[model samples]
Target: MSVRDLNLPQREPSRGELPSRVTIWEVGPRDGLQNEQTVVGLGTKLEFLDRLAAAGLGTLEATSFVHPKWVPQLADADDLLAKLDRRENVRYPVLVPNERGLDRALALGVESIAIFGSATETFARKNLNRSFDEQFAMFEPVVRRARHEGLEVRAYLSMCFGDPWEGAVAVDQVVTAGRRLLDMGCFQLSLGDTIGVATPGHVEAVLGAFDDVTRLAVHFHDTYGQALSNTLAALRAGVTTVDSSAGGLGGCPYAKAATGNLATEDLVWMLDGLGIDHGVDLDALVRTSAWMAQQLGRPSPSRVVKALTGG
Candidate 1:
């Protein structure tokens, strides 16, 4: 079927104080498939990235360079990069846990890399196996080296809104942690609602602490069914970049309560209604997610994908 045959959302006139163009940072290949029980083959992963890029997703998080023991699903990161048919207009970023992961990414000629960090002490110890403050000590060299190598470094600050082990994360605490990553030469910091417990008001409060919204990206999970609303709130606060997983495919391997990242199709639907120019072809994106869901041997959790494909 052609893209025009899909039941697409009608584009309304652009309103409100939101940015005219939003950049949807697609994370399906990396974060989406990292914790899957059914291991997706290397060819499927590469094709997933290709399909997403063909759907007009400009920035695709290709995969993680973490130790295979941690995320065995993405063990073929080296081969994936070597055989990837990279597009000149597309940006493919990989997740690198530390200096060693950075080395692997650097060896593959990766231009952009992301380092994951935690906001709360409990999560830091659990996810990174280091204390909250000590985690930065580890990332400092990674960020510094990546900068020196002329690679753009992005930081992921998890548990920004709420943590399962730790209660409500203070807005100021999140701000300070995010600032540390930014000061260390990271170009963009993605504030993650790891547990998906963030509300719109809480999202506004947390984002309000940051001085520059341009350097901020919001990664929301839909565990509490608030991801899209919180994302809209973030968009209103001048954030243009959003991290979403295609077909709603990922959940935290460490944080069990964290369900899935915001679905790219769902976000695109809301953006379409708001008349936001996100450069994504909604019909094509829905089709891509639907195909990915089939590969995973499950239905997509995305409302937009389900609605468009009658899944």
Candidate 2:
């Protein structure tokens, strides 16, 4: 019984103008574990990264450099990077909240860093402790210095479609915030459906507002069972990078309603069926997530993992 024997997700040829290749930004190591009640040890985290890299996830969000006061789970970011087995083919990106976090990452020679932003004012204040317009001021210097220091920078705009406090976020508002981050030298902008309330139409409209889709990526949560649908909309609109959590292991500490992220295994299955070239081994990914589930003392939330492993 090998992975080949599974014969899952029957591949089919591309039907439309969708990109043949997609970049799946795996966030299970960072965003996926940040909200966990139990702190996963550093050795386990390192092995998790190794397994994900072996499974062919090119870009892995390794961990966050936020202060221990905020996210104690990722407080070992410094140690994790120090002990990590760096791979030439894989890109390890860490989240740097502000100047201090960037300094920590720089001290360890981190090559890539991601900044978190908010598409709505309420989320901005709650998540970043800054006003809607004020959050940019906090991120500008960080992004600028990261670029000047020759590090790849990514921006995450949370609450893109709808916020818990704010019933519905305007498309223009998301575009404005996203553009500001992009203009500040972010190489990529990841639009986050923090509460996962976005539908296909809203996803299309939000992506359409942008002039360039090349630098855009979508990070959808499956809170409303619409992550896959919204992902299809993004692909139709020409977005090639997608953010997903392995094992669907994440939620927002700030947003009570926010649930687990779109699972990497589930996304890979859909990509496989669509004949999109993601370069990830679905069986390996499912096994990795399933193993992670055992570590966390729960079953993986990925539908594909369940279907394949009969969990």
- TM-scores, all models, native as reference: 0.95, 0.96
State the lDDT at 227 in candidate 1: 95
Candidate RMSDs in Å, in order, are 2.2, 1.8
State which candidate has the highest TM-score: 2
User: Which residue runs of candidate 2 sit more than 4 Å off their true CA positions?
Assistant: 1-16
Give every collision pair in model 1. none
Clash tally, candidates in order: 0, 0
Ten residues in a row with the worst lDDT in model 2? 1-10
lDDT of each: 0.91, 0.92
The TM-score measured for candidate 2 stands at 0.96
The per-residue C-alpha lDDT of model 2 at residue 216 equals 99
Q: 246, model 2: CA deviation in Å?
A: 0.7
List ranges where model 1 is wrong by over 4 Å: 1-16
Q: In candidate 2, what are the lDDT values of residues 134-214, reduced to their tens digit?
A: 999999999989999999999999999999998999899999999999999998999999999999999999998999998
Residue pairs that clash (backbone atoms under 3 angstroms), model 2 = none
